[model samples]
Target: MAQKRDYYEVLGVDKNATEDQIKKAYRTIAIKYHPDRNPGNKEAEEKFKEAAEAYDVLHDPQKRQQYDQFGFSGPGMGGFGDFGASMNMDDIFSMFGDIFGGRAGFGGFGGSGTRGRQQHRGSDLRLKVRLSLDEIAHGVTKKFKVRKDITCSHCHGTGAEAGSSSEQCPTCHGSGVITHTTQSIFGMMQTQGVCPTCGGEGTVIKNKCKHCGGTGVEKGEEVVEIKIPAGVAEGMVVNVPGKGNAGKRKGVNGDIQVFIEEEPNDTFIRDDNDLIYNLLLDFPTAALGGEVEIPTIEGSKLKVKMEPGTQPGKTLRLRGKGLPAVQGYGRGNGDLVVNVSVYVPKTLSREEKSAIEQFRQSDNFKGDAATKHTIFQKFKNYFS
Candidate 1:
C-alpha cells in the first residue's frame, strides 16, 4: 500500500494551526471534493475521505497530540487500521452532515438526496499494561477483562422487545430527516435535519426492551485479546479496533487503546534499544584479563574476553545483543555496551603494602610520561 500522507499535509495546514483553522481547512476540502459535487469520481471521493481522516485526528486534542508527538505510526495513532478507509460515503455523510449546516442530503447545493438513519459510534476505551524488557523485545499477546457497554442479548441490539418490531417514525414518515423549505432572496431553499422524535433512526420501537431500556446496550464484561508489537516503549498506545464499548441501537463498536508501560530490569540499563551493563572487575581480573560472563536480556549469559591491563571506563560492544527496533521505525537489533570498572581496596595489610611498595619502586610499575599522556588523551577523547 502507498504510504499515507501526513495529516497536516493532507489538510494543507501547519503543525501549529488552531482548532478552528483545522476545521475550516477540512470543510473547504470536503466541499470541493464532496461526492455530490463530483458524482462517480473515485479520486474525488478518496480525497474527500482522506480530508475527513485528517480532520478527525487534527480536530481532536488527544489524537492531535499523539500525531504531533509520534507521527503516523506512533502509539494510538492506529497505523494498522485506517479509520477513514474503513468507512463508506454514507458513514462520512452521517458523521459530518451537521458541519455542513444541515445540507447533507437536502435538495439544495449539491445534496445527495435523502439518506438512511444516522448510526452512532461507541466511545473509545483506554487501558494500560506493564511489560517486561523481554516481552518488549519479543512482543507478546495479552488478555484483559474489560468492563464496558455491550449489546443487549434480549433485544439483540434492535431495542425492541421479543416478538415485536420497530415501526416507521411518524414525525418524518421514516425518512429519518425533516426538510425545511424557506423562501429567501436566493429563491426557495430547502435544508434537511435529523428528526427529533426518532433521533434520526427512521424507526421507533413501540414496545421497548425491558432489559436495556430501549438503548440496545447494557453494562457487561468482555474478554479482549490484544497483540502487542515488539520494541514498543512506555506511553506508546496500541489500538484495537471494535473492541471498546458497543454502540447504542446497533451502531458501530469503538476502539480499545492500550498504553504501554515498561517494567524495570535489574541487570541492564536501557538506552533506547541498547542495553548498558556496568561490569565491576577485581584488580587481578583487570590486570590479568580473562573471559567474564555477562548477562543478556534473553535470560542467558554471554562470555566476553577482557584484554590484559583492561582499564576502567573501557567500553566493550557486543553486536546484535541489544533489543530490536520497533517495526517501521528502523531495521535490525541494537548492540550491548559493557562499561568496565576495576575495584580498588580501601585498605591494605602491612605485608601487602610492603609488596606494593617494592613494585612502586620498579620502573616498569611506575607511571611514565607516555602512559600519563595516553591516559590524559583517553579522558580528553571521552569528554569530547
Candidate 2:
C-alpha cells in the first residue's frame, strides 16, 4: 500500500490548529466530498473518508495532543492498539467520540487507511416529522421511528465464527489499498483502489459468523424524540445527537436529523412565527360594522369586529394571536388581512325586481344617480 498521507495534510490544516478551526475545516471538506452528491465516484468518497479520519483525531483536544506528540494511531490509553496490531475500527471510532461532536455513526471507512482494520458501525438513519398548527403555535414534542443498524448479538460483532480470527487478504497481501498504473496524457499515472479481496479491509474472516455472516452489524429500530420549539417554521430541521445508527465495534451512534414538515391547515398558513388566514364576508357585512367568526391556531374561533364601510385589502390586527417565539424571540401575533370582494347579483327574481322598484320610489337611492351607484349609497347608510 502507498504511504498514508498525513492527517493534517489531508485536511489542509496546520498541526497548531484549534478545535474550532479544525471543525470548520472538516465541515467544509465533508460537505464538499459527501457521497450523496458524487454518486459512485471513488475519488470523492476517498477524500471524504480521509477528511473524516483527520477530523476524528484533530477535533478532540486530547486526541489532537496525543497525535501531535505520538503520531500514527497512538495508544488507546492503556497501551492498547499498538501500530500493526489488530484494532476494531468500530471501537476506534467510538473511542474518538470527542471529534465528530457526537455524530460518529455517519462516518464510514474503506477509502484510505494503514491496512487490515476491523470495521463495525450501525448504519445512520434519517426521518421526517410533521407538526400541527397548534403544536407549532405552542411548541411540542414529536416522537418517530428509524430503522437502523445494530450489532449482531450472535457473533458479538466479531464476524468470525466462534473463537476464530480473520485470515489475511490474498489480493493485496493484507494491504487495504492497491496501486494501479495507467497511461494518460500526463504520462504513466499511478492510482489506487480498495482491495476487493478484503473489501479494503486488510483482513478477512475465514469462518464467517453464523449470526452476521461476516458483516458485524444487524438490523434494528431506533426511537427518536424531537422537540419542536414554539415559532419553528416549516422546513426547519432539528438535530438529535447520538440517535442515528449504532456504530460497529461499539462506536458512537450517529445523529438523528429531525426535519420539520408541517401539514397545511384549511384555515391557516404560517409565515415564520406569524400565522395568516383569509376571512370571507358578504358585501353588506363588510360595508356595515359587524362581528364575524374567524378560526385561530389556538384550536378555536375568534370573533373579530369589522369597521363600517371597510374597503378592499383592509387588515385587522389580532395582538398575541400568532405563534409564540420558537427560540425565545418575542411574543407577537400576526395581523389578519381581510381582502373585500363585492358580491354581484347574478339574476333578479320577479319579487326581488318589484321590491327594488318599490325601494327606487323612495329618495333613499337618490344620490349618485348620475353614477347609478345607488347601491353604494345604501352601503354608506349601513354604518350610519
Candidate 3:
C-alpha cells in the first residue's frame, strides 16, 4: 500500500489550525468529493474517505498532538486501525453528516434520501498503565479486566424482550425521520429531521427487555489484551479499538485509551532513548586503568575498560546499549552513556596520611605548570 498522506496536509491546514478551521476544511472537502455528487468516481470516493480520516485525527486534541509528536508511528495512529482508508460512506455520514445540516442518509444535498437511525457510539474508557524502563525498551502486551457496559444477554442486543418484537413507528411510518415542507421566497423549502416519537429508530418495542430496560446494554466486565509498541513514552496514549463499552442497541463499541506512565529506573537516567549511568571510580582506579562491570537495562553486567588517567566528567559510550526507537520511525537503538567521576577519601588513617606526606614534596606528586593551568581552567569553568 502507498504511504498515507500527513493528516494536516490531507486537510489542507497547518499544524496550528484551530478546531473550527479543521472542521470547516473537512466539510469543504467532504462536500466536493461526496459519493452522491461524484457517483461512480472511485478516486473521489477515496478522497472523501481520506478527508474523513484526516479530519478524524486533526480535529481531536489528543490524536492531533500524538500525530504531531510521532507522526503516523505514534500509539493509536494509522496502522492500528480506528479510522482511515477503511472508512465507508455510512461511517462518514454517521459521524459527520451533521455538517451537511441533516441526519446521516436523510434527504439533503449530500444525503441519499434514505432514512437511517443514528447509531450511538459508546463513551471511551481511559486507563493508566505503568511500565518500567525495561518494559518500555521492548514492547510488552498486557491484559486488563475492564468493567464497562456490555450487550444485554437476555435481549441479544435488541431492545425487545422474549417473544415480543419491534414494530414500525407510527409517526414516521418506518422512515425514522420527519420531513417539513414550507413555501418560501426561494421556492418550496424542504427540511428533514430525526423522528421525535421514535427517537429516530424506525421501530418501537412494546415489551422492553427487563435485563437492560430497553437500552440493549448492561453493566459487565471484559478481559482485554493490549499490545503496546516499543519505545512508547510516558503520557502517550494507546487506543484499543472496540475494547471499551459496548454501544447501546448494538451500535459501535467504544475504544480503550491506555495512558502510559514510566517508572523511574534505579541505575539509569533516561534521555529520550539514551540511558545515562554515572560510574564513580576510586583514586587507584582513576590513576590506574581497570575493567569495571556496569549494569545494563537487561539486568546484565557489561565490562568497560577505564583508560589510565581517566578524569572526572569524561564520558564513554556503549553503542546500541540503550532503548530502541519506536516502530515506523526507522531509527536504530540508542547508546548508553557512562559518566566518569572520581571518589576522594574524606577521612584517612595515620599510616595513609604519613605515606601521602612522603610524596607531597616529590616532583611527580606536585603539579607541573601545564597541570596547574588545567586545574585552574577546570575550577574557573566550574565557578562560571
Candidate 4:
C-alpha cells in the first residue's frame, strides 16, 4: 500500500485554510479529475477518489480538527478511511451533489455509467479593474455593467413557447444518448453517442420561444457591484459568483473573475504593505534639526523630524502608516520608511561661498570628529 498524502497537500491548500477555501479548492480539483472529463483513464479515477476523500474529511468540522491534530490515524481518530474501498461514484456524487447545481455528477459531463447528457455551467468571464493606491489602502466598492447571455424573459429559460411544451426525443427515445453495436473479428462492440434529434437535451420543443429562438437565452446587460478588500495586490482575482453568462436552457450561471490592477501612487512607492517615500533635506536642515512636511497616501501631510547630523541614506520609520495586510496575517499595518537624501545647491552666491569657506577654516570643523570621539570613548572605557 502507498502512503496517504496530506489532505491539505492533496487539495493544494494551506493547513490554515478556511472552510470556504477548502471547498473551493476541492471543487476545482474535482472538475479537473472527474471521470467523465477523462473517460477510461485509471489515473483520473484515482485522483477523483482522492479529492472526494479529502473533501469528505475536511468538510466536517470535528473530523478536520481531529485530522489537524492527529493526522490520518492517531489517539482518537478512527483512521482516514480508504476512499477507494469506501466510496462508490454515486456516494461521492450524492455527498457533493449541490456543487454541480444538483446535477449529481462531475461537471461538464454526465453521471458515471449513465449516458444522459448533462447541462454545463456557463463560461467564466474575466475583466481587469484598476484601483488607486488610496482605494487599496481602504476598501472601495465599484459598479460596472457587463453584457452577457441571460435567460429569456419571455420563455422563463425554457425553449418552449407559451401553452406549448417539449416531447421526448424520438431518435434516442428520451435516453439522451444513442447506442450502436458494431461487428468486428473479435465480436460485437457497443458504442454510445449523443442523440442527434434533441442535441442531448432529451426533449425537442414543438413551438420555439420567439425571444430566444429556442436557445432559451438572449444577450443582456447587468450591473455588477464588487467590494474590493483593503491591501489587495495586483493580479489578485476576486470571484463574483453567479454573475457570468447564464447557462444554456437555464443551467447554472458562471463566475465573474475580477483581476486587480493597482494604479501607481505619485507620492509613495508601495512595497508589499509598506510605503516608501524619499525625503529631501537641505544642508542646513541636515546639520541642524528641523521638521518638514511630507505627503501621505491618504492626501494628508505628515510632519517628519530630521535630527541634527541626519545623513543621506538614513531611513526614518513611521509605524502603522502603511496599508493593512490583505490576508489579515502578520502585523495588520506596515511602517512608512522615509529615505533621507541631502540636497546640494547647484550654484552658490559669493556670500554663500565665503560663509562655507569660513566654516571650513573653523577649529571645531574637523572632518573625522566622529572617529576621534569613538576612539576617545573606547580608551576611557578601557581605563575604567
Task: Provide C-alpha RMSD values for all models, in order.
Answer: 12.7, 12.6, 13.1, 11.4
The window of 10 residues in a row where model 1 has the poorest summed lDDT is 104-113
Q: How far does residue 284 in candidate 2 sit from its true spot (Å)?
A: 7.5
By lDDT: ranked, best first: 1, 3, 4, 2
1-384 per-residue lDDT for model 1 (tens digits): 778999999999999999989988988899999886775599998899999888878887877888888888777565323867766665566556656765753323223556667676788899999999989989999999999999999998888899988899999998887776756332454556678899878888999999999999999999999999988889898989899999999998989999999999888888988999999998888888898999998888998888888888899999999999888988899989999999989999999899888988888667689988999999899899
Clashing pairs in 1: none
Candidate 3's residue-wise lDDT over 48-128, tens digit each? 888888887777677677778998777766432346555456546655666665644322323454557656668889999
Model 1 Cα shift for residue 235 (angstroms): 1.1
- lDDT of each residue in 136-167, candidate 2, tens digit only: 77888877776777777888776777888877
lDDT of 2 at 102: 43
TM-score of 4: 0.65
Q: For candidate 4, give the lDDT of residue 237.
A: 86
Q: Write the per-residue lDDT of candidate 4 for residues 1-384, one digit (tens) a residue.
A: 778888899999998899999888988888888886885598898988998888878887877887888787755343345755555664566456556544545443343433555464677788899999999998899998999988889998887799988888888878776666666323453446667788767888999998899888889999999888888989888888899999878878988899999998778899888999998899999989899997877778888777887867678889888889876555579878889899999999999999989999876556488767976876799799
What TM-score, to 2 decimals, does candidate 3 have? Answer: 0.69
For candidate 3, give the lDDT of residue 265: 87
Clashes of 3: 0
Which segments of candidate 2 are over 4 A away from where they belong? 1-130, 166-175, 181-188, 228-261, 270-274, 280-295, 299-305, 317-384
Give me the displacement of residue 309 in model 1, in angstroms.
2.1
Candidate 3 backbone collisions, by pair: none
Error of 3 at 168 (Å): 2.1
Distance (Å) between predicted and true CA of 168, model 2?
5.6
Instruction: List lDDT for all candidates, in order.
Output: 0.83, 0.64, 0.81, 0.79
Off by over 4 Å in 1: 1-114, 180-190, 377-384
